[model samples]
Structures are given as C-alpha cells and as structure tokens.
Target: MRTDDVLEVMNELVAFVRVAEAGSFSAAARQHGQTPSAVSRQVARLEKVMGVALLQRSTRQLRLTEAGLDVLERGREMVAAAQATVRVAEGHVGVPRGRVRISAPKAFARQVLQQPLLSFLQRCPEVDLHLMVVDRPVDALREGVDLVIRLTDDPPPGMVARALMPVRQLLLASPAYLSGRPPVRTPEDLMAHSCLSLGEQERDNRWRWVRGGDVVEVAVSGRYTVNHSEMRLAAVEAGLGVGCVPDFVARDALAAGRVVQLLPDWVFDNHYQGTAYLLFAASRHTAPKVRALIDHLVAALGPCAQPV
Candidate 1:
C-alpha cells in the first residue's frame, strides 16, 4: 500500500480499537460523537484488510478473538501515541491538566475518597474530576472512566491495578441488643440471633468466617435486609439485629459506642470485603492527571497513612 492507503488503514485500526474498548460500536460512537454504523463499517473494513475476524458478536456483548486481542494492544499504542502528540502540541506537555472521569462505590466515596478528592482538586487546580459514585458494577474499559476504585480479591484482566488497603467485614451489634442476646462465643451461636445482610441475593444472608486454617459458614436472616452499608449500620444501631459491615462504614459507629464488634478474632468473606484496589486500563502512556489522583488516594487510604 502507498502512504495514503497506509493512513486509511491506520484510521480503520484506530476505529476498531475504540469499538473494542467501548465493548460495542454504539458505545464507541456515542463517546466519539459518531454513528454506530460508521464505527461498525470501520471495524469491518479493518477486519477485511487484515484478513481475519476480530470480534465475535453476540446479543448482549462483544467478545474478542485471539487475533483481535493482539491487534487491540497495537491499536491502543497507536491511540496513546496520538493522544500524547496532541497533548504536546497543545502545550500540555508534562502537565496534569484536563478532566478525568472516575468511578467509585458510594459508601467508600463518602467515608474515604470524597475529602481526599476535594483536597486533590485544591492541590491541582488545572485538573478537573468527575466522580461517578454508584454501588452497581461499572466497567472501567467501556464506561469512559479514567479510574475506578474497586474492592476485589482478583481484579479483571487487561487493567493496571494497585492494592490500597484491606476491606474487612466487621461483625457488629448494638450494645443494647447484645446485652439481651446470648454471647456469640462460636460461629454457630449466630443462628440464635437475627443477622442483617445486603440481601440483594440469596447468598448475601450466608456468611463465611475464617480463622487461620479453620472456616465456618453460617446462614442467618433478619427482618431488615438492605444493600446499603450506611442503612445497615443504622439498623444495627437501632438494635434491629446482628450485622456484618465494612470496617470503614462501622468505624464511626464503633468509635462512638453506637455498635460493638462481636467477633474480633474471625474474618468474614463476602462480596464486599476484599483488598481495596485502584484500577486503570493498561497502557504505555498514563496521563499525568490520573497518576496524580492515584498517588494522592494511595497516600491517604494506604496503610500507615493518617486518617482524614
């Protein structure tokens, strides 16, 4: 191919990358202010030129073929280089200035990140941030988010992840409620008491405790079952039942004597409890603004750091 033909091929490859990263042609089009059909054609053209099918399309989501994955890495590098070139030309060289979209959980944002994010804005005036605070799942790759705060033992692949802190499940109950109920000496003793859980699913009421090599799983139910951490903490404070909540959510309550931890020796495993992680898409180039915010959060939320 000649020089102009090469440029067209590069454009098609870049479009394919965007569609793949966005998880759908429609999402990529929306993000880029283009039509889905246009994006779809670009990807199809690229596939035809490359002589290989890149994606396996399904009703719900797009899945990458082996060749598509390899092409994605190269195309991502091309996009990153183009972005860096534009930034340099725009006089943003080595400067952390721009809007960064982020996704974080609601309770974690309120309890931990909100204040630090405010402080970061004050420290870096040129960098703007958009925080999408929600408890529901958000895909960092397809959501147009620059950063994501997640608590998971195993983070999704194809992303760069940093472990910030351990999220513990602290078993708790109000002093008044615990005063009336039998002491929870063993894990089996929880069967006698009402246990509050997220109850978003059947397994939320089921909990597993780990102590060294020993493991204990219990099934306990309560009248109030809500997915919100703060709401569950409120229920525990009202002496509704025993509760297993995130340590950070129960921190203020535990310090204020509103609730007391039942078993300090055992650790519980749940959907919510895991190592807190900061994640971003893997790339040869990371923006300065995203790096700044990640460093600030790690300093504030990491172990041995002073609480805000």
Candidate 2:
C-alpha cells in the first residue's frame, strides 16, 4: 500500500476496533467525535480493505466477527507503535512549545507541586501545562498525558521514571489528643491509640515503624477513612487520631505544634516510602516541552534526589 493508503487503512482499523470495543457504531462515533454514518463508513472501508467482514451489526446488538477480533488485537499494537513513533519524532526536535499534560495525586498537585510548577511555567512561557489531579494511577499513553507524578516504592514497569525526592513519612498526633496520654516512645505504644487510615488498601490500615535495626508492623484502626492524604492530615490536626503522613504535607503543622510527632525515636520507614517520579514514554525525551518540564522538575526537586 502507498504511505497515505497505509495511514488511511490504519485509521479505519482503529475506528473498527473502537466500534467493536464500544459495542455500537453510534458509541464509537461519539467517542471519535464523528457522525454515526461516518463511523460505519470507516468500519466498512476497513472491512473492504482487509477483504473480510469485521462486524455483525443489528438494531438489537453489535457483535464482532472473528476477523474483527483479530483486527482488534493487532490494531491496538499497531496504534501504540504508531504513537510511539510520533512521540519519538517529537522528542528529537526539542521545540518545547506545546502543551504538556501531567497527572498527579490531588493533594500533592495542590499542596506540593502546584507552586513549584507555577513558578516553572512563569519562567518558561512557551510551554502550557495541563494538570489532571486524581488519586489513582493513570495510563500515560492511553490517557494522552505527557507525564505522571507517582509516589511509589517501586516505579511502574515500562517507563522512564525520574524520582523527585525521598518523602519522609512521619507519625503525628495533635497536642490536644495527647494531653492526657503518656508519651509514645515505641511502636508498641500505638496499640493503645487510634490511627487514621488513608487509601482503600488494607495495608494503609497497618503501620510500619523502624527502630535501630528492627522493623515493626502494627495493625491500626481508626474512626475515619479517607482517600485523600490531605484529609487524613487534617483529621490528625483535629485531634481525631494519630496519622502517618508525608513530612512535606505536615511540615507547617508540625512546625506550628498543631500536630506533634508521635514515637519520635521509632520512624515510619519503607512503608509509604516512595519517591515522586516524573514518568513518561522514553520517546518523549526529545520533545522540547517534555524535556523542559523534566529539567525544571529535576532542578526544583534536586538532581541527586531522583535517578535519571
């Protein structure tokens, strides 16, 4: 096929895959921002090009033929490869004038990263930042996000991750809550108190503390459960319970004595211990905007902190 013919065929195949996945031409049309007839025509064009019927369609239901299933499996890989190729080409130019989409946790995006990013943007006027604040991991390529900031002990597979910093996890409790309670000098003392929970993971309800060479895991329970780390920190400030949170998030509160460190000698280590990584496709290294943002983040977060 000619180059343009190949491109048209790939586009049609992709449209067919979308229709099959969505289970309706109309749904795929909405997804692709094209008319239903246009979507149907594209699928038909794909079937004609491939010399196979791709879909079994009816007023009641849409079903994929065996050829459609084969195309779906192969088409996804083709699309991904094509995208990676484009990204690689974009990276090499280093023009740095396009929008850079980033995904990060809401609290970190708002509290920790936003100010620094804003400052970076002020200095680099050519780049536009699109920040998607969420509490869950996003598929960087599929979501069309240029980069992602994740707090993880181990970086996710198949991406170039640049760690920003080592977040110090600390155990904190409000002075009001500790007024009558004895000082907690060890992990064992936490057994007598309530611990706030963050994230839905069962592991979040457990506390891990390290002292000298020993590491301890204590199962903790609380009256409040929150998905956002900021909310958990606020609950700790309100004297509701002892909460373990990142030092950066609670730094001001700790300084103001709103929340005092509990078990000062026993540190929470290797649990909730992770560096914030600026994850992106390795191909994006050449893109000017992506490279600029990565450089800014490394400078802001520090170079020695995150491995390249």
Candidate 3:
C-alpha cells in the first residue's frame, strides 16, 4: 500500500477503536467531536477493507466479534504509535503549545499540587491542562492522561517515576487538644488518648512507629473516624483528638502552632507512607509540553521534600 493508503486504514482503525471502547457510536462521536454516522461509516469502511464483521450492533449495546477482538489490540497499537508520532512532531516546535492531561490524588492535588499547577500555567500561557484529582491509581495510556502523580515506595513496572517528595505520615494533635489530654510521650502513651484515624482499613486502628532500632505498635480508638486527611486535621485542630496526617497537610499547621506533631522522634508507618512520584510513559517525557510541566513541578517541589 502507498503512504496515503496506510494513513487511511490507520484513520479508520482509530475511529473503530474509539467507537469500540466508548461502547457506542454516539458516545464515541460525543467524545471525539464527530457525527455518529461519520464514526459508523469509518467502522464500516474498516470492516469492508478487512472483509470481516467487526461488531455485532444492537439497539442497546455493541459487542465485538471474534475478528474485532483480534484486530482491537493492533488497532490500539497503531493509534498509540500515531499519537507518539504527533507528540514527537510537536516536540520539534519551539513553543510548548498543547493540552497536557494529568492525574493526582485528591488531598495532595487540592492542598499541595494546585498552586504549582497554576504557577506553571501562568508561566506557559500557551499550554492548557486537564487535571483529574482522584484517589485511585490511573493508567496513563489507557486513561488518556499525559502524566500521573502517584504515592509509592517504588514506581510500577513499565513507567518512569520522577521523585517529587517523600511523603511522611505524622501523628498530630492541636496544642489545645494536647493540653486537655495525657501527653503522648511514647507510642504506648497513645492508648490513653482519643485517636482520630482512617477507619477504611482494619489496620488503620493499629498504628506503628519506629525509632532507631525500637518499634512500637498501638491499637487505639476515637469518637470519630474519617478517611480524609484535611477533615482529620481540622478535627484535631478543633481538639477532637489526635489525628495522623500527611506531613504536607500538617506542616503549615505545625508551623503556625495550630497543631503539634506527636512522637516527633519516631517515624509513623502504615498507609500513605511513600514518596510522591511523578509517573509517565517513557516515550512521553520528550514531548515539550510534558517536559515543561515536569520541570516546572521539579522546581516548585524540590525544596519542600526532605533529603533522601
């Protein structure tokens, strides 16, 4: 086939893949800003070229035929390759002008990452961003995001991780709260206090800490339980109880004397204790828009992290 012929087939494959993944022609049309008939025709053309029935269409749902399933993986590869080609072409241009989609956790995105993202957009007026703040891990290529900020001790396989900061979970209480309660001199002392905690997991009530070669574990309870870090911090500030929170969430409050860090000499351990890593597909790092955002975050966040 000629170059144009290959391009045409690839374009039809793109449309088919989108429609298949979206579950309906109308849905694909809405997502891609194309007419339903246009998308449907593209799929039809692809079926004609391959001489196989790809989809079993119905009034309620669309199901892929066996041939469709066989072609789907290759179609995804072609689309991804084409997207990478576009990104490489964009990288050659002098200016960073494009949309960069990213995902981050809810608490970190709102409390910490929001300002830096705004700062970057302000500096690079030509670039636009789509930020998805969700708690669950997101797949960059599958989710159609440019980058993912994940909190993990080790980056997952098949992705590049740029270390942003070390995330430390700190046990804390407002000075007002501590004034009324028994002092938390050690992990065992926590048994006497009302400890706010994330009740999401059974182990949440079982808090652990380490100092030098010493290890301490405490099982405690509170009047109120919440999974949200900010809410727990607020409750602590209001003197509700001792709450464990991310260092980032508690840092400013600690600095302002709104809250006091408990067990300052010990390292708190459990969920949410890991380095915040900026994750991306290896091929995506070279794209100028992605590179710009990555660099911007590195600069903005470097000083905030404790030395590893």
Candidate 4:
C-alpha cells in the first residue's frame, strides 16, 4: 500500500475508536467536527477493507462485535503511541499549551487543590486548568479528564498512580465541649462522652484506635451523626460531640484551639484516612501539559508526605 493509503486506514481506525469510546456516532461526529453519516461511512469503509463487521447498530444503541472489541483495544494503543510520538516531537520545539482537566471531590477541591492549583496556574500561563469537583465517583477517561486527585487506600485499577500524601484520621472535640465533660485521656473513656457517629444508621457504633502495637475497639454512641467530613468537623466545632476527622480537615481548628485532639497517640482505623493519589492515564504520562501539572502538584504538595 502507498503512504497515503496507510494514512487513510489509520484515520478510519481512529474514527471507529472514537465512536466506540464516545458511545455514539453522533457524539464522535460532534467531537471531530464531522457529520454522523460521514463518520459512519468511514467505519463502513474500514470494515470493508478488513472484511469484517465491527459494530452492530440499532436505533437506540451501538454494540461492538468481537472483531470490533479486538480492533478497539489495539487501535487505542496505536493512537496513543502516535499521540506520544507527536508530544515528544513537539516538546523539544514548542511550549506546553493545552487544557488539563482534573476531577476531585468537592471538599478536597475547595480545601486542598485550590491553593496548589492557583500556584500552578501562576507558573504555567499557557495552560488552562479545568476542575470538575464532584462528590461522587467519576469516569475519568470517558469524561475526558486528564488527571484525578482522590483520597483512597487503593487507587483506581489500570491507571498510573502516585501516592502524594497519607491522610491521617484522629478523634477530636471542641475545647468548649471537652470543658466540664468527662476527661478523654484514654480510648476507653470515650464511652462516657457524646461520640459523633459516622454512618450511624448503617453500621454498629464502634470506633477503633491503634497505637504502637496496641489496638482497642470501643462501642460508643452519639446524638449527631453524619457522612461528610466537613459536617463532622462542624458538629465537633459546635461542641456537639467527639468526632473522628482527617488531620487536614481539623488542622486549622486544632491549631486555633477550637478543637482538641482526643487521643494524640492513637490513630483511627477507619478507611476514611489513607493516601491521596495523583492519578492519570498511563499513556499520557509523557505529554507536556499533563507532565508539567503532575510534577508541579507533587512538588508543591509534598509527594508521599503524610500530614503532621
């Protein structure tokens, strides 16, 4: 085949892959600035050239055939390799200029990401930063986000991830609440106090504490319970009860003497406190825009540094 023929075939494969990824021919058309019929024709031509049916089409949905599934997996790799090649060639010659979209939780976005991102924006004038702050799970790749910063013990599977920081959970109570209340010198003493419950409706009111090879589990009850970190912090600050909170969330209050740590030596064993990971698609690690932001975040936020 001629060079032009090879390029045409590659374009067709890309069109097919985009349609599959977008989940609709119309969506791919909108992305590529082409009509749906044109994109469909491109896929049809590729099917004819390869002598196999790729997609089973209906009015409501499009499903990939077995051949389409195999083609898509390989085609994405080829497209990524091509993109990486372009990025490498351009990086040596041009400045980093592109939009980098990031998905993060609402609370983390407001509290943690805002300052670092502001610094990153100042440093990279050519780059446009897009933040998608949601309280629920996000489909990073499908939604076209370039990176994600999430608090989890385990990062999402099949992605390149770096542990940026370890989140620490500690029990806390406002100084006002602690005053005239039973002294919480030990984990066992928590039973006599008003404990803030997380997921009070779903689980038993049991709190776990660990300190230097010693583990203790105590069953405690509370008047107020909430699922959100900020809410728990608010209730604790209002002198409602003793609540468990991430160190980052309670840092300002602790320092301001608004809330006091209950057990300084003990750590909460709940899954809420773990590590914050910087995650991105494995293929786009070398891209200039993505690489610059990842490097900046790791540097400013102190990668793998646990909160004191």
Candidate that scores best on lDDT:
3
Q: What is the lDDT for 246 in model 2?
A: 82
Query: Clash number for model 3?
Result: 0
Compose the digit string of candidate 1's lDDT tens values, residues 183-278: 998788999999988878878877888899999998887889888889999999999999888999999999999999988999887778887788
* Clashes found in each candidate (C-alpha, N, C closer than 3 A): 0, 4, 0, 1
Give the better candidate number (1 or 2) by TM-score. 1
* Per-residue lDDT over 197-261 for candidate 2, one digit per residue giving the tens place of the 0 to 100 score: 77577687777777888999888787888866678899998989888888788889988889888
Alpha carbon deviation, residue 38, candidate 3 (Å) = 41
Tens-digit lDDT string for candidate 3 (1-308): 35576576887888999988999999999998999999999999989878889999999999999999988988898889889999778764778878999999999998889999999999999899999999888999999998899888868888877889888998888887877667889999989999998998889899889999998898999898999999999999999999889988888898999988888899987758789988888773367788889889988886553322
Q: Quote model 1's TM-score.
A: 0.70
Candidate 4: TM-score?
0.67
Model 3 lDDT, residue 109, Cα: 96
Q: Which 10 consecutive positions of candidate 1 have the poorest summed lDDT? A: 299-308
TM-score (C-alpha, index-matched) for candidate 2? 0.66
Q: Rank all candidate structures by their lDDT, best first, as comma-separated numbers.
A: 3, 1, 4, 2
Q: Evaluated with TM-score, which candidate comes out highest? A: 1
State in Å the error of residue 173, model 1: 0.6
- List residue ranges in candidate 3 displaced over 4 A: 1-88, 303-308
